[model samples]
Target: MATPDLRELYLSLVCLITLVLILVGGVQVVRHGLKLLLPDPPPPVFAPPPEPADSTAMLKPPRSYEQAWQQTERLRLQRQAIRGLLVNLVLLVLAGLIYRAHWRRLQIMRRT
Candidate 1:
């Protein structure tokens, strides 16, 4: 049997690589989607009110600080999930496009 030409071989290799990339990207996107959809419930934050004191009252942190810290943590988690989702989506799309293009080229080469 005749050996495949270099162009065809290269195109086939690219198609395979791109398909792998697409699969990995798709998996990551799905994982990220699940993370966003069913995110772990944020742990409860509780801080007891400071006891009444004349001098130390000014030193004690307010209850709002605890609330603010919790809010910041939640926001950070949300941001990470969103960023992951976006990045994975971009990877999936680009890889899919590349795979399609290379597959089409391979098909055309085979037709000749």
Candidate 2:
């Protein structure tokens, strides 16, 4: 029975891991695209009642709901991008470790 080569095994492992990471990134991109294309329905708005004459009533500044929704969507996209970047970074680290192991094995084999 022929023994498997360590370098080839490690290289294949690295390639497989890289492929999986790419697929995951692609899926995330597609999901984000879909989210952009099909957004949730607008929130229901209720009219405010007449202000009471009581001097104790504190009035707060009015904020635009559309602006809030835009900010939220922006944050969501940013978070998704960051997540994708982190995943790619992890995959690169794993590949680097595997490559280092493969190089060490080659060095040892050469020394023999």
Error of 1 at 75 (Å): 1.0
lDDT of every model, 2 decimals: 0.84, 0.60
TM-score result, candidate 2: 0.45
Report the Cα lDDT for residue 45, model 1.
Answer: 68
Kindly report the root-mean-square deviation of model 1 from the true structure over all alpha carbons: 3.6
Give the per-residue lDDT digits (tens) of candidate 2, residues 9-54: 7665665675665567557656655655664544444445547776
Model 1 ranges with Cα > 4 A deviation: 41-62
1-104: candidate 1 lDDT, tens digit per residue: 66899999999999989888888988888888888888766676654565667656666657788678778877888888899999999998898898899899
Worst 10-residue stretch by lDDT in candidate 2? 54-63
